[model samples]
Target: MTDLALLQALGALCVEAGRAILDVYDAEAIVVRSKDDRSPVTDADERAEEILHAVLAKLFPGVTVIAEEAASRDGAPTEAPETFLLVDPLDGTREFINRNGEFTVNVGLISRRAPVLGCVHAPALGATWIGAAGRGAFKAEAAIRDVPAPAAYRPIAVRQRPAAGLCAVASRSHADAETEAFLEKLGVVERRSAGSSLKFCLVAEAAADVYPRFGPTMEWDTAAGHAVLAAAGGAVTRPDMTPFDYGKAEAGFRNGGFVAWGARD
Candidate 1:
């Protein structure tokens, strides 16, 4: 399929997955469990993953999918193919548990060790971001069961760095001293805290100028948002200023520290 078509399909699937999440989110009691890795998991995560897996199977046929819940259950592959899909059915589980409306459904397509297309949907916030390498990025206000037409989405891009000062975004749930020190070194004048992959979206939309993540993150955690930010004319790199790419199956798909910038510095 074309990149644009794949992005649209992923967006729709993420929206559907978001609906499943909301169903569990609205329940009187949300049951949570600990994964083998000691991370939190919920019915919302599994249910949404089920939906994404089923739809993706029918849509893509033979493509490999490395989803968070599944990987947590069945150990991750030691090596990945040149192309695959990375999925985090429900990102920011803490935020979801807190009912902060900051969690998201993420689907990203990785090709040649890079995110070529992605879609992120925050159901509670009624927002979605979709992007592809050559097709650019877009944002839409799509509520439950509301799939906005392609034209309804407004194109989005990162802005030039402000001459006055830089604005930075940090994870609300997983802040670390390294990230703080990095931001301080960058001389960021303003800082915003957010949950899930919204930090990448913030920079992608020019709401913030940078997001430095020093804590551990999985490929699924950042791939979708990374795609969006890159498509919006931004970049994600290692703290040392090296390129950031995916398909790190050797390390159980774990990610090292990285910095996301609205514009190249």
Candidate 2:
């Protein structure tokens, strides 16, 4: 399949997974559990993951898929292949538990240690963001199980850094002093707190100028949003401004501190 076609497939998959998540989210009771790592999980997470895994296995047979719930249950691989997928079935379980409209379903493709394609779908918000290496980036109002038409998707790009000072988006659940200090150093004139990968989409769509993440994150947590931001003319790098690549099987796919910038000077 072409890159654009692949991107569209991923987006559609996310939307399908998002539908499963919303079904659980709208239930009368949402049962929350804790992973071995102590992070929250719910029925929404598992159901969405099941949908993604089954669809991915059929859609792209033989490609390795490292998903969050499965990795937490079964140990992660010590190394990754040249090409693979990272999935966060239900990002921001806390937001879902809180009945907030900030959770998302994320799927990202990593090739040669770089995020080449991704899709993030926020079912509660009825929005989806997609990006690929050569296809640019776009946002659409995706409904449950119904992928938006090509014309329905609007191309999006990062905005040039504003001279007035940067507008920064930070993690709402995992705030830290390090992130605050970094934003302070950046002279952030405006601040927004968001849950899940939406912070990256904020920068990707020019709603914010940057996102600095000092708290711990996994590859699945950031990869899809990273692809979107990168395709929208942005960058994600270490706090020291080094290159940020994926397939860190040595680190159990855990992410280090990184900053995502829109258009930079």
> Model 1, stretches more than 4 Å misplaced?
none
Q: Write the per-residue lDDT of candidate 2 for residues 80-117, one digit (tens) a residue.
A: 99999999999998999999889999998899999988
How far does residue 38 in candidate 1 sit from its true spot (Å)? 1.2
Q: Write the per-residue lDDT of candidate 1 for residues 1-265, one digit (tens) a residue.
A: 8777777777888888999999999999999999987989999999999999999887777989999999999888888999998999999999999999999999888999999888899999888899999899999886565776677689999999999999999999988888888888889999999999999999999999999998899999999999999999999999889999899888889999999999875
lDDT of each: 0.91, 0.91
Candidate 1: Cα lDDT at 261 = 93
Q: Estimate the overall C-alpha local distance difference test score of candidate 1.
A: 0.91
**Clash-forming residue pairs, model 1:** none
